[model samples]
Target: MSVVNNLVDIRALAALVPDGAKLVVAKDESGVAMAATRELVRRGVRNLHLVTVPVSGLQADVLIGAGCVATVESSGITLSEFGTGPCFTRAIKAGSIRMKDATCPAIYAGLQAAQKGLPFMPLRGIIGSDLLKHRDDWRVIDNPFGTDDKIVAIAAIGPDVALFHAPLADRFGNVFIGRQRELMLLAHASRKTLVTVEQVVEGNLLDDDARSGATIPALYIEAIAHAPKGMWPLGYGDAYPIDAAWMRAYVQMARTAEGFESVVAQWLAGDGALKPLVGAGLGELAGAAA
Candidate 1:
């Protein structure tokens, strides 16, 4: 609805989010994704809701300090067979957030229900799991159809705002997501979407099908910001990889509220190691975190 293409500071973006707003973050190796979450927490946003196809190590740490509730949309089979990191488990232990295991389809179904202005969607798979017990946000209702089990009345998730970082975008707010469709889904589901891009391309340059293959139309976007390496801690696909050391440090710092505040102070003071990458664009700052 509102499209802005400028190199706005992360703090300015953070200011746009209000306290107690429900935030849905994309847990990926993208600088924008990670930075968005950091900004939200710094801005005093509580009641955060983190959404990821499969939550990442870095995202788990951010969630812990933000006091966010994590909604994971990936099969437990994978995480159980090949263990997920201790991020979520540790957060639960610390009483920082709650965790729910579900599929991306469930997230989509819930979001779609919201976008369609529906009250809720009946889901079959989450019937008797601990997911039901913890999701006080969703209402569980009887199917009343025949012999099937009760369904989870997944409420629509209409977030007040959504922030993301991408490879490129135009001044008019058209985004190029490259090969990551999961991130695109996040942008689409939110009520108002904000994006930070590595660079601003000419609007017409995106006409080519090859370059525009992963583009999200400008109509749904509200603003476009040029912030490189905005997804720090998280990788930006081939553009840059995750900085494991930085992620580890973030994990250590977020273990306590005071430590989390210290990290935020460094971020605001422009003393963060990740600050320089914000200028070089996504690829320039990729993997630059210490």
Candidate 2:
């Protein structure tokens, strides 16, 4: 495909996400692609295996509330200062979705194993915790070298698609995640990396020595969508700050099925309530990163 083809609209981006796919999302509070996520909901995408890198906030909660998710594999899902995610809490309470609870480090290790093309990754913690009891894919292996010590091994996480938002990306598709280096592992671990960014730069990001360490080259990015201020309700550096009041309102609306629908309806229909979150509007979204 031509470099221009990589940039696509939000609807196109959402359509690129196959139903029932194993979708791994970015980390908590940072790099959460809420703009693309809203598009996914609008498109009615469903049965997703939503894996949060570690912890999650609005992205996971909104997807769960929209019924776009079938299973959630994560360390935990909360709205941070907003407290527990109402929709996630409701789903767990109702047994509406399968849960693969994990620790923050374990999730990171799983992704790391996949990035390294390993079958599994060994971890040190969660040795005596109940978290291990529920996970069949984890095993306790004795130290074969000496001293008879045991460590936990977790299966590698190889997602069909990895998604996140960033501050900027170059026209050549190099994504600048800045200090959020875990995104590099996320892209490496997944079969495809879909990105949405605040803006697109003109030159090649890899050519800049200062940003080389913080950039995920075009080779790892499969698609790009323009989503200025896309990370709304979830801050991304100084470009924006979390919309605490909106989050609180969402928490209230998500408390019940009907209330949640009210929020979804407003969001999907471009109601004024959510206009601030849409940033540059859908028309300006989806551009070739390469």
Candidate 3:
């Protein structure tokens, strides 16, 4: 089958994200796609139902602070080593956004249900915790197969769009997510998947022996944007290390309302320099195995 070349400029990529869209993003420390995120903020995409698979860090926090997100769903939002996510906390405290607190496994199950086109997914965890108390969609049921065991059923999480960064992609649009398997679930579960890649390769990734298993085929992807150092300030599973000092400074700068605004100002300034300049070595991982 012929594949449409979905590769687009970063701004054009941002334009594809509709306002009030239900969006799912990759987890913290892996495939965060900060460059695409800043473009979304610059375009003022609003009222998003942002779902973070398992956990989040800078991506969720900055979006919330920029007034782009109206609701957030995730296990937790933190800056990891930098500390808590200040903007996410502030938005929750000020009642500016709706919050759906979920556990990691439950979030996975919800997306898995969507991936499999199932009404709900039966998960083993969160049955005895307070996490279930806040979620009306989750139900604890006795095993119907004659066992005395109980199971928790979580409703499917089907997002309007799924977004993430990947180490590399091919001309055919197949993305190399490596061992970050959650990205596969996200792409399958969402109605559309937008991707950013460090570089674009020549042949079909599925035909490459090393990348076939780690690849999310072109058919599932809606658009692709080229963005080197796209996961700056966050680790990319050894593509490059996280920028620790920059992240620490960000933590301090984002601690207050005014400070956080300044952080955005500096990043979104200079027309388009918000994209980080670090990590020029991503090309080294272009054709290599994960």
TM of each candidate vs. truth: 0.71, 0.91, 0.90
TM-score (C-alpha, index-matched) for candidate 1:
0.71
lDDT of 3 by residue, 1-290 (tens): 45568999888888898999999998865588888998999899999999998888999999999999998999999987789998998899999999999988888999999999998999886767988888888999887885888999899999999999988898888899888888999999999999999998887899988899999998899999999888775767767787777687678767777666666766665323222223323332221212
Ranking by TM-score: 2, 3, 1
Better of 1 and 2 by TM-score: 2
Highest lDDT: which candidate?
Answer: 3
Better of 2 and 3 by lDDT: 3
Per-residue C-alpha lDDT of model 2 across residues 143-255, encoded as one tens digit per residue: 67757799998999899999999888887778998888888889999999999999998877778899878998888889999999888767778777777667777777677
Top candidate (TM-score): 2
Instruction: List the candidate numbers ranked by lDDT, top first.
Output: 3, 2, 1
Can you tell me which runs of candidate 3 are displaced by over 4 Å? 1-3, 270-290
The segments of candidate 1 whose C-alpha lies over 4 angstroms from its true place after superposition are: 1-7, 29-32, 46-60, 63-104, 136-151, 252-262, 267-290
Give lDDT tens digits, candidate 1, residues 177-216.
8776766666667776777777777654357788776887
Query: lDDT of candidate 1 vs native?
Result: 0.59
Candidate 1: worst-modelled 10 consecutive residues by lDDT: 73-82
